[model samples]
Target: MTDSKLAIIILAAGQGTRMKSATPKLLHTLAGIPIVSHVLATARELDAAYTVAVVRHERDALVEVIVDELPNGLVVDQDETPGTGRAVEQAVASLPADFDGDVLVINGDTPMLDVQTLAGLINEHRHGGASATLLSAFLNDPSGYGRIVRTPDEPEQESAADTAARASTPLFGRRVTDRNGRVDRIVEHRDATDSELAIAEINAGVYLFGVSELRDLLPQLTMHNAQGEKYLTDMVELLRRAGSEVTVLPVAESWLVAGINDRAQLSEAAAKMNALIIRGWQLAGVTVQDPATTWIDLKATFEPDVTILPGTQIKGATTVARGAIVGPDTTLVDCEIGERAVVKRSDATLSVIGADATVGPFSYLRPNTILGAHGKIGAFVETKNAQIGDGSKVPHLSYVGDAHIGVDSNIGAGSIFANYNGVTKSETEIGSNVRLGSHNVFVAPVRIGDGAYSGAGTVVRKDVPAGSLAMNVAPQRNLEGWVATHRAGSAADVAAQAALAPQNAVEASAEQPAERTGE
Candidate 1:
């Protein structure tokens, strides 16, 4: 629910040409979420009266995500005018015309802008009682950003250089009274002179302004810069001229407001976010064995004493209980890992592993799979929509799909719950203490009763009664010399002939021995 105190306007209409992708720049994923979501998350935390997204490029796609992420959000489309000022003007118009609260404007591309920093800016502005608060940062190289020029510290003792600067731009000449070190104006990098370009302080593109102050000054913006666009930075000059105190907040870390304009920046932000998340988890008593190789989405939760091993990705609201150890290469998506469960080298999605359960050395658990306490979905096994009861083990090299196995049952290696026939898929049910043997295929719609045993190489198509055994038993037959005949001149044939030579010699000796004894 929105309340009347703050209105956050996220400017997302810019077409990011440097990103060079078919997908809209704001839709690009950063730390497992869209870039705009990072800024939107901050807005939600602020409990703003109006959360407005100003969009022009990829409007439909951007709106879909916006509506999904924030159901009550207001969306405004910027008109044909190509400027940040115009984008924000359209957004502010969408809100209540009489909203006399703070208007927090932020760029859509800066994913590193967190809720705490923004809240701090808002708090500082509110307490300081400024008409507008500007976020600024001093960079070692402020090459491509607008430089922030402040009014003279001593208004009465203006030097010759200062007078020339104030006289050169109409923005500086708008002052009617004495100004004492307020943010005078922002000079665009393309428009700045040599000395102005040397200024290390750059405008951070974030602003907190009184709605009335912002509304009043927005119309005064002019398209006189290199791009012939009414830059939002122009508001600093306009606000100062209107006798409004523009508070400049020099952020401690400039990266907090850094914009992601290319693939390199995207990856850089992701790495920094991952490191921050992992460090936070570690501080909360979760052991991350390899922070460099591990990643976790924002919605994932963990209990204390959980050990996250190397190459683990906990994605999408996954929860790991205390004493659980995940990975050494594992990916879990929207799954729940119970207490003391050990999941190694596995991939599971939307599944539940109960307490003390063990999964994988290469297991693939599909959605709806639930392993009960002390159960094992072991090496090379794949399970889908299967419910494994407590203490049951599907130990190796098996595919168990659309099946339910009761407690203490063991599914043998190379076994498959053949749940699908051509037309539709069915299910297999194995009862308690059942021993399903090696190479068995449980044809769908079949059930094995309690205490039953399935013989090796069995194909179970019918139900087995309690305590009964099921097998497709057949008599063993030997095709004598089959390998020698069929595999002629091969290794088997050579070995067969070598064995026959000894027997042939023994038979000859027996046949000749009688004649030799008689002689």
Candidate 2:
């Protein structure tokens, strides 16, 4: 990089008319971050002394995002006179006067421009001793891009003999340059002549200029162009006219210089960004089962040897420790997964799972839910603001909230911590080694002590001491003949009659013997 002091000016003033939506183009997100945020972050990576972003359309919204991303950065609104040159001028006026550092100017919508390229461009500028440096790309169909006009000292010498060779040569996407060392001028596609339109080199909307040089040349710009705007590209011509070296840097990875102007381009840029992220994780010793189906956030992280399964979205600062297996249809946001734990087909937010804990084949863990080591929150379970101790298990089909369960406790299937009493949400505490039966409901503000047992169908409303067996106090009763009576002449009645016939005959025989003896 350059040893000189550096600052950056980001152009975000365009209306993005082609995006055709109410949301500002810079606010549209890819990989969970606003687009200009990516550009700001990349710019900050250069360790610039200061950074300024210029905004016009949607200035307030763009300013909010920029301040959040780069808190110390400056945001200046461009005045009504429209042009990229005017935007940079407004940004430059915000910086310290007499600051003779190199200023990097870039478009905010071009988020895919990486830091390495910017650093290389700065190095080229400082080492080449050029007055201004611009990044350029060679596109196969460079329509709508401003064409780079090299000095005519080197004209095309394509002879008839080599015409076949020139056609056969592939220029699909590669950087080719000449030793001209300077560009004469730049022509926008709308204003270019037929001969100039055939040029493959196009401006990439990234430039490096000496601060004094930019401050000198910007005021000379006029609204004489087709758009009646003062274009920043006109500076290249102004610098050349003053006998200054206006150098151009050709980037080999052209997509790094690509700009996002519409929905289709946004999608393409997203795919390219995701591909880079996935490959980075793969190279870092994390196993990604299906890269195509997984979406990992820029803030999310994984330790070495973690396995990420398919159809998963791990977003918002979520961290998975070593040896953890996650996904195969799961979403986790801002959560922590401990070492060797397995999370399958679950959705959790703002929660933490301890080491070796098992969560879900289908579970919902809401905010503040924390499971201790070796704890299991199994299939179809939902938990919120609950703390379950080590070796405890809420196996299946339960809703646990505002509760704390001690170590080695077992919460049976279909049990619920009835914490909400229509208005007030209450708490439930089950002590260590408790055995809670299926279908039990713990009405809250209640506690079950250590080594206690609760029978099935019990609704616990009060406290139970240690070593006690709590159950409903009602005695069991038989209502055997009620179904037959209520369902008379039906299947139950017929079966009941058939069953009583033989018994009735035996009773009659005994009665007859008794009668005979009496006589």
Candidate 3:
């Protein structure tokens, strides 16, 4: 690697008319992160001495995001002279006057660029001692891209591998060299002649420049192109004319430097980024059953042996520990899933599931809910602002909110902690070993002590002492034959009459079988 100090300049001033949105193109998101944020993160990985973002269109919003991601990064505004050259000039002007280092210029829209490639580019530039180095790639169809023009190599400079490669297939671009073998300038497709248009090698729009040389040449840039913009590609020709070496490094993987200009390209980039993230997790011992349907945010973390099923989205600082199983259809946001925990077919946010806990076949855990180890919030359950202790269970068909349940408590099916009254919300507390029966409702501002038991269908409005049993059901009473008297011919009356008949009455009726039914 080069020992020279590195500065990264990201150009984000383009008004992406093709994206057809009010939001700046760099602010658009891919894989739940802003495009510019990804580029900034890559630059940080390279440990650049100074990182600068040049913004003009949507300047304030773009600068805000840049500062938020990289608080110490410098932000420069490109002046009204719209061109890539002017953008880089503004960034160069922001740097310290005495700074002399290698400058890496990249597009804000290319989020897929990686640190390794950039390090390699810097090394190549330094090794060759070139004034300027261009990153180039060979595309099958090089439409709307600037074509790289390379002068033929001298026989003495050509290696055996280069000779064989060039001889086997006609090289992508025409071999044009002056008397001395040197690279020519890159020509935009519109400016190229008929023969130049056939060249497949295109400029990838990423460059490494010697800072002192670039600063000197920025003033000489002229807007003589058909688009009426000061072209950065012109620098290559100017450096060559100055008797300085210009180098070109062909990137093996073209996607690394591909730029996003429109919606279709953005989507394409997103898909590629998602695939790359998924592949990384798979290599790290996390099982992603169907990578296509699973979306894991860049900020999320997963430990070894975590299994993520299909249709799952883990987002926003969520972390899953080893042996945890999440999703067949689940979304978890800002939540933590502990070791051996299982969360399936559920949506949870801002919660924590302790080790060995299980939640959902269909459940919702809202903000501030904490489920302790070995606890379960079963199917059709919803919990909010609740803390359930170890071994506690809200089995099914229940809502427990603003509540605290101690260890070993069993909340029965069809039960609810009625935390909200008409006026305001309150909390319920259940101590250890409590048995809350089915269809029970514990009204807010209530507590059930340790070993307390509640009867089925109870409505608990008051606190129950330790080891006590609480029931508020009305006393049972039998209004004999009331249904028969009230509705003579109804189904209730007919059932009542049959139930009232004696056991011997059936035997007696069988013995007298000859009676006329019509009568």
lDDT values, one for every candidate = 0.87, 0.88, 0.86
On a 0 to 1 TM-score scale, where does candidate 3 land against the true structure?
Answer: 0.84
lDDT of 1 by residue, 1-519 (tens): 554889999999989889999999999987678999888887788888889999999999999988887789999999988899988888888889778889999999988887777877788788877888877766677889888886666244232244333431211122212232367888999999998887776788999888887778788888988999979888888887878788777666667888888898898999999899999999999999999999999889999999999999999889999999999899999999999999999999999999999999999999999999999999999999999999999999999999999999999999989999989999999999999889999999998999999899999999999899888979999988898778999988888889899998988888874444553
Residue-wise lDDT of candidate 3 within 1-519, one digit each (tens)?
A: 423378899988899888999888888988878999999898878878888998889899999889988888899988889889999988999989878998999999989888887877788678867898777766677788998776555333332234224321121112212222246788988888877777766788999999998889988999988888988888899898899988776666668888998999998998888888889999999999999999888888999999999999998889999999999999999999999999999999999999999999999999999999999999999999999999999989999999999999999899988988888999999999999899999999999999999999999999999999999859999987789788998998888778768855877888885857784
What lDDT, from 0 to 1, does candidate 1 have? 0.87
Per-residue accuracy of model 2 over 1-519 as CA lDDT, tens digit each = 433489999999999988898999989987778889899999878878889999989898999899988898888989999999999888888989968999999999998998888988888788888999898876777898998888878565222243223321121121233563479999999889998888877889999999998889899998898899989999999999999998887676668888989999899998888888889999999999999999987888899999999999988899999999998899999999999999999999999999999999999999999999999999999999999999899999999999999999999999999999899999999999999999999999999999999999899999999989889988989987786768988987898889988998999888874334553
Q: What count of clashes does model 1 give? A: 0
- Model 1 residue runs over 4 Å out of place are 1-3, 152-181, 511-519
Model 3: how far residue 384 lies from native, Å: 1.6
- RMSD to the hidden true structure, all candidates: 5.9, 4.5, 5.7
Q: Choose the strongest candidate by TM-score.
A: 1
TM-score of each: 0.90, 0.87, 0.84
Residue pairs whose backbone atoms clash in candidate 2: none
User: Which run of 10 residues does model 2 get worst, by summed lDDT?
Assistant: 167-176
Residue 171 of model 1, lDDT score: 17
